[model samples]
Target: MNALFFVMGCVDGRLVLTLEETADMLGMALQTAYNQIDAGTFPIPLRKNGRKWVADARDIAEYLDLMRKEAREAHDALKRKLAA
Candidate 1:
């Protein structure tokens, strides 16, 4: 019954991060995140859980971290090219 406990990985169960959190973490729009889910690029979420889209928190965090690292590297390369 305690949603807050889920955020800290305290519950002995799977945690679902909201689409908004996922989007914010990836620095992307809500639609873009939905598209990835729709296109099967991102992990599919659980269904109709009373009104919220439910995705594994671990998956969302991992995907965002990976994408963030890649984006930063790409930006660095572009900066180097411009500086050269």
Candidate 2:
């Protein structure tokens, strides 16, 4: 699923995502997401909501945007280096 779509859907009044949604947005298996949470490596900051983990939709969107920006910058740099 497109990360922007997922995030925008949530931004329409839904401020948090369940662990499963978070995993899908990150393109990781649910188990892997849980493992990452346990290992303290989940890319988006999460918080405990009763018995489940929840993440802010805005945080996920911001993280994805940052990653996309960095990737684009890296690709541009590589092109420049290759052209030189």
Candidate 3:
């Protein structure tokens, strides 16, 4: 819908994303995104351009795949715990 289009526009044909756009895409607060970047635990590697942080779409996709795997593992673990 309209929301989807808005999110898509956040990244251009170059696949570049600003810190705020990346935070919005990741569903986290802007401050939290900065913290994660500082801690080096963000979903993907970001490049610093002056005072802003930038992310690539390919990296974000990879991060999503990694998160999906972790989620599946956690779900399986919870099911086992409940069965026991």
Candidate 4:
């Protein structure tokens, strides 16, 4: 299967992204992204380079897939419970 990466403005070289780029790709505010990273609630882990936070696009995509799988499982369980 293939993975989908939603973030743009990146060259074909490195898959790294700045916090701002990650926030834009995630449709959230910059501060919110930072908060999530700090709170350890972000989908993927980030690396701190001196004073900046960076994320890997591939890791983010993988995390999204994992979240989708979890949500689907939860929804299926809920449907089964309701049907019972």
Candidate 5:
């Protein structure tokens, strides 16, 4: 997970990330992020707060962790295959 996300302030007792922050975390354009949200294809769930979309910080962190674990496992499998 990104260190920037960890330092984000909380809103209403929950650590939530703005749409821009979520886009940055995912390395996508702001417009792309909006499109993904509308299409319901974003990896992390989001909800509209007033006029903007926000995602739970914990959810983003968990998704990142899961992606990292999967990538590491795939790399290890490839290495084992090559060694054999």
Candidate 6:
């Protein structure tokens, strides 16, 4: 949880991140990150400067946590239902 909070607060005010950095952080392919952004599942980049797409690191981290929590809850609910 502290780690998550750290990532969320890393950028002081703006959550800035380059496409390559985000891909590395998320362990995803560079193109996959772009595709997810294109599909609107991921947070949108605030600016496109030249060949780069920059996103808010905080938003991305928070969004990732939200998705993870949702998935965990769903799986736990499923397990409970199966046990009952």
* lDDT to native, each model: 0.62, 0.84, 0.75, 0.74, 0.77, 0.70
Question: Least lDDT summed over 10 consecutive residues: which range in candidate 6?
Answer: 1-10
Q: Model 5 Cα displacement at 28 (Å)? A: 1.7
Candidate with best TM-score: 2
TM-score of model 3 (CA atoms): 0.68
TM-score of each: 0.50, 0.84, 0.68, 0.68, 0.80, 0.65
Residue 60's C-alpha lDDT in candidate 1?
58
What value of lDDT does candidate 3 attain over all alpha carbons?
A: 0.75
RMSD of 1: 6.7
Whole-model lDDT, candidate 4? 0.74
Model 2 gets an lDDT of 0.84
Q: By summed lDDT, which 10 consecutive residues of candidate 5 come out lowest? A: 3-12
Which numbered prediction scores highest in lDDT against the true structure? 2
lDDT of 4 at 38: 75
Q: Tell me how candidate 1 scores on lDDT.
A: 0.62
Query: How accurate locally is residue 53 in candidate 3, as Cα lDDT from 0 to 100?
Result: 86
What's the CA RMSD for each of the models?
6.7, 3.2, 4.7, 3.1, 3.7, 3.6
Candidate 4 to truth, TM:
0.68
Residue 28 lDDT in candidate 2: 91
Candidate 5 lDDT score relative to the true structure: 0.77
45, model 3: CA deviation in Å?
Answer: 0.6
TM-score for predicted model 1 compared with the true structure: 0.50
* lDDT order of candidates, top first: 2, 5, 3, 4, 6, 1
**Reference-based TM-score, model 5:** 0.80
Model 4 pairs whose backbones collide: none
- Candidate 3 C-alpha lDDT tens digits along 31-78: 998888788887768898898888876666666666768899999999
lDDT of candidate 1 over 1-84, digit per residue (tens)? 233344335334447666776566456888987888788775534344677666666665555566668899999999999999
What residue runs in model 5 are displaced by over 4 Å at the alpha carbon? 1-14
Candidate with better lDDT, 1 vs 5: 5
